[model samples]
Target: MNGGDVTEEAGEPVPESLWLATTSSTEYEPLPGDRRVDTAIVGGGIVGLTAAIRLKEAGHEVAVIETGRVVEGVTGHTTAKLTSQHGLRYDRLCSTFGREYARQYATANEAAIDAVERRVEEDGIECDFRRTEAYVYTESRSDGSDLLDETRAARRLGLPASYTETTPLPFDVEGAIRFDEQAEFHPRKYLLALAAAVDGDGSSVFETTRALDIDPGRQPRVTTDRGVVVADQVIVASHFPFFDRGGYFARVHPKRAYLLAVRISGEPPEGMFYSTATPPATIRGAPVDGERLLIVGGQGHEPGLDGPATSERYRRCEAFARERFEVESVEYRWSTHDLSPVDGVPFVGRLGPTTRNVYVGTGFDGWGMTGGIAAGTILADLIVNGSSPWADVFDPNRFTPAASAKALVEDNALVAARFLGDRIRTALAGSGTLPSPGEGTVVRQGGKPVAVSRGEDGELHAVSAVCPHMWCLVEWNDAERTWDCPCHGSRFDPDGTVRSGPALEDLTDRSG
Candidate 1:
């Protein structure tokens, strides 16, 4: 395949998302020097860009600092389903957080959909935005009852939901919970417009500027690699808060999922659909040029856990697509990582009780489109009006020990066990021979675990295997060719550059 071909090739040379591949690239200069603004937004994804636009609209000077290009992170890689139907969530929310909180979750998500639609209209962003119905269905008879309960719960909470025995899917589902007037769009296109709107009027967007730390004070200072952003308030909108003072490492668990965009021979389904079954599947249609592509996703697992190879996950999605739909060719393949909150809801306000000036929005699980928008609105309201109606529910400091106790214990225990176990393995294995070209492995070097990779050109590259986030050993990801932290999902390049964070620093190079 040519380098520009959207289709998958033998070596998976183009790991770009469909949205990113189709959209035009835009770049912004890095932060020049120490600057001042009313708010400093770290990260330029859906949440940070939206928050910057909202804050600028509220007449506040805002600056958005991004380590990479805007919207190129998880936002660009998402399936872009703008629906409240998050895999039988209403029933669980009602059971776990009560009906009122469930109602708020529904309301907030619905409002977020409205906000996106309104923005597209008001800003004239031709991002292929469209309103469609969304369904959560299951093939298992036992899980059908949960769908029924969720339908009832959603309707009780005033959501536009209904229960049906049939759906637009090719397969016959046991039943489905359908939400009407939901939406989908090209996330990168929409977010790029938002990033554009965030510029001008005393506000700015800076790319390739990584934020190092937040100097908390009366005026919080966001220290960046190039300069500093002194502001009255700061929003940690990075997918995982880079500054981890709020203990987000324990509150959220990261999972990676694969997505494949394939040209289908048959007519694509009209509605967005998600499965409630184990090893969940999500199906939706995306219009690329004049053609509609079937976007099939979902084969989630913790990053760096060696099971089936990552390429195997993409193959699984392709196999599923071929089984259900008449697949012609896979147009694109990509992977994204999301943070799942222990409490089943995102944290979207102040970082903590004491850290009032710094706020964070994280743990959207796999439903960041609506969650990110809602978080941006909540953060904007809090920064401007000093409060929001939904503040208490999404407060980062709000403790619901009973709500997340099991998850908290289980997740952190896994982290601790993995950390100690990886160290023990490295210690026992001792130094070994270097990997062949186009491969990576961890070996003991100088009594320390060293991550070594041989590039395609046959040059050896080595770095410390220990993650800067919490000192957990990072395992090499064969599919993405990066070192992914099993603990908090921090990823680094083969030569030790930071790819994603919770870890602000690059891996220590030990190649020499």
Candidate 2:
């Protein structure tokens, strides 16, 4: 879910995820006082909610504690594409990994989609759930042949994927692969409806309850700011689990991607689109009261560092949309962040052997919707019964031999480079004053370091320059107008309210 509505200017379009615009709305009060349950699921996105619902159905008492409003994390901001095609993953999975493992991954995704269709039909969710053919196309000259390998691998895995030389897209593609029976939906709508459905009986959702940490053991304890939720099992469904026991911080890196919802005059094509190129564009359309919205996304990077180039990508996508369809207005614009595992598959299962009862789901690789649902099902099976056929595949304990080694060395080297580079830059600029206003700048004020932002309104806001979580200097995000810590991914509002965490406290007011 995109974090709850932050302050936006009047007459200016607010930044809301595409899923938020499409999902149904409701007013849900935050959780009050202490609570204990058979299961406590942290994070209120699709994964957490799905796990809570399944646990409740299995006759376990459940409570979902969310730091912000439900469906406001990455899920709400997603392109909301639910497909098994993750950009030529089949060929790589079969080659780098193994054929059987690749097949299992494909089968799990298919099962996830089927499960969602069944739930949507049985529960009658009004979230615009629809099945559409999904495509992965590329214009890159040398790599067009990879599509053929992907098609063969997919066929070997018993998937309904095929290679296609032609598509409805205006641009010419050397090649593309089509995956049948993939899906798309209004994510926030599905999540909120799921919350309402789970509200009765054994399950409930608690918003505005921040989880501080966990005390793990045979019966793990989840610690929240308000109170504790001691349970037989605890699922950390937060986009990145608050607890970093599984070395997830090193295993997966956080990346940001932008999305724009455009009103199109032409009828939307019958299929969903993705590309096999860097800074790729993923496009699809949804009907809203006789009109169609062209949802385009895909300039991804490490959150705050993309610089001016990121905004240009969004503009380029807008131009592409206009070239294809009569551009109506840009209805919504937002960005989302996700944790992508180094090995390209999600880490879903027990957090670690030492803490058997604690489960986590992360590193979706842009396939969160399907991966998250499958994760919930796997976790539910683990908690309720004992074993699942899919356990070993997604097990956190299973290590990737070469992938893990390269990830550890390369990620650490990158982090060190960033840390040292920031220090050098700060030292060279003696005063630490920023180059301009309306940009995030670190400056020394009255012998103290501070973070300063000059808003579009010309009002200046200042806070402690040091990040609350790790003391890294915070950078200004021009697009979102927030302070982002380049080191640990903690984010704060322009006025210093905590957005994403590891930083439980707000940035201290420097003006005072």
Which numbered prediction scores highest in TM-score against the true structure? 1
Off by over 4 Å in 2: 1-14, 22-26, 304-310, 323-325, 430-437, 445-449
Q: Predicted candidate 2: what Cα RMSD to the true structure?
A: 4.3
* lDDT of model 1, residue 208: 95
Cα lDDT tens digits, model 1, 1-512, are: 00121233333425779999999877889999999999999999999998999999989999999998899888989999999888888878887887777887888889999999998998899999999999988888888777778889899999999999899998788988899999999999899988888888789999999999998888999999999899999999999999888899899988888888888887799999998866788899999889899888788887655567676777777767766777777778899789999988999999977787999999998998999999999999998998877766788887777678888898888777888889887888656577888788889988889999998899888999999888999987777888889888888999999988879899999978
Error of 2 at 274 (Å): 0.8
* Model 2 Cα lDDT, one tens digit per residue, 107-174: 88888888888889999987888999999987776776788888998989998899888888776878
Q: Which ten residues in a row have the lowest lDDT in candidate 2?
A: 1-10
Q: Which stretches of candidate 1 lie above 4 Å from their native place? A: 1-13
- lDDT score for candidate 1 against the true structure: 0.87
Candidate lDDT scores, in order, read 0.87, 0.78
